[model samples]
Target: MTHVLNRIILTAILALFAVQANAMWIQPDWYEVTQPGVGTNRYAYSGNDPINNFDPLGNDFSKAPGDYDFSEEGAAREEAEMQNRDLDGVTDGIIIDKSIGHLSSGPGRYRSTQKYLEAVASGKIGPQNSEISRKEALANIRDLGEQFEQRSLVCDASCEAMVPGPGQTSAIGASVAVVGGVAAGTNSIPTRGKFKGSTPGTSPASIAARQAFGNTRIPGNVRLPAPTAKAPLQTSNRVGTVVGRIGPIGAVVGGAIVGTQVIRRDSQVLQCMSSCYSTGFLDR
Candidate 1:
């Protein structure tokens, strides 16, 4: 019975030592400095829920097992989708501004052109992933071409006034010259000589015109493969195009009406001034 008691005591001592060795081996040397309460327990792993959360690097808990995927293909597809969405957003804004906001169309076109150039440089306008179909890619290119055409038209009409060609005078410039000449009682107010031959390609308006011409022809230059399936026509895009076409007409009519009002107001002011002068009110 004494021998049996000795054996029992020896077994208990070995078990205690084994438990201590296991604890020492598994306990972490470092703690989470960011979380003081949790850092106090160096042995804590994944908020003490090892089965639900994993912390392989002894940092924060990772997403629940199988909850999130981290892969190159997935990331690429996501980026491509985001780019396509951005392009769509820009297209929508341009359509709305061109159709309903004609007064601010110049700025709208400028903004859209910048966005298009960015998208092109980033390779966002073309098919970036397998998720985008050929038809969708073609449509994106077509939209870009249309935007370029619109910008070209706007630049032709307005940018000339900003940076007129050599020897070419803008209507506003001509009107000012004529008025100044009349006031000074001289016909020697030099009219800008007629367009003198070729304009240098380095000029701002010339460069813009060249860029617009090149961009407008991009769709024709690209050789896209035939789409496997036919894409349905989008009615909203058709409607927007129609409205954009009509916007300029509306703008012209509105300008005429405003011009008439301005003329009448100017006539009234002149009559008042004449009466004031005749009554010697000007002398007072």
Candidate 2:
């Protein structure tokens, strides 16, 4: 009994070590992000006071040099005539140029905002030479997913990172059997016992003999062919890990494994990063 227990424990330990060995190293990339016109004058609007809250929707015409409310008829006619006189000096007096006004300036701001989004998508936010390579960014995010796993970042109430692995599948199967056996108490118990004999590259008689007696080979009589090499192990090394960078941007730790897959699999990554950034944890 002690020997069997020892073997089980040893197997469990080995399985654990194997799992850890395959784990991706996820760490946060603290490198600052860079984008054109970010925190610079190109993004700034000329003649717009940054210190004051200028409301274009407000009725105040104080900032609008050409617009004035004239209550008196004489004043209103004189202002209109003066404005027309100013237009007469232009080369094309009949053509009214609206772009010279401040109202058209808002579109430039809108364009700058679009450029910002484009920069983010292209991963070119900082100085021309300053940036993490796409490969390194991917590698880093995978590591973050592993870190999230270790930190117990639960997705919904049940799922963590979807670590698809042979061991986890085996564990889940064993769990199901254990639960079902306790619940049903059917003839499946015998079928459960037969599962151990289901190893590859074994004969039916040998399986039967193994099932009947603990050992397979009859010591002196029939010799069996040697087993082939162990199958290459599969692990959850590709599981995605996300880490935040810049203000809202995030990096992946093991990007090489799951980088291309994350956007397709989970659209919630952006939401996750947004939440993490709001709480000021993802940057860490």
Q: What TM-score would each prediction reach against the true structure?
A: 0.16, 0.15
Q: Any runs in candidate 2 off by more than 4 Å, and if so which?
A: 1-129, 149-280
Q: Candidate 2 at 189: error in angstroms? A: 44
Worst 10 residues of 1 by lDDT: 99-108
Evaluate model 1: give its TM-score. Answer: 0.16
Candidate 1: Cα lDDT at 235: 22
Per the 3 Å backbone cut-off, how many clashing residue pairs does candidate 1 have? 0
Clashes of each: 0, 18
Tell me model 1's lDDT, rounded to 2 decimals: 0.30
List per-candidate RMSD values in Å.
39.1, 25.0
Q: Give the TM-score of candidate 2.
A: 0.15
Best by TM-score: 1
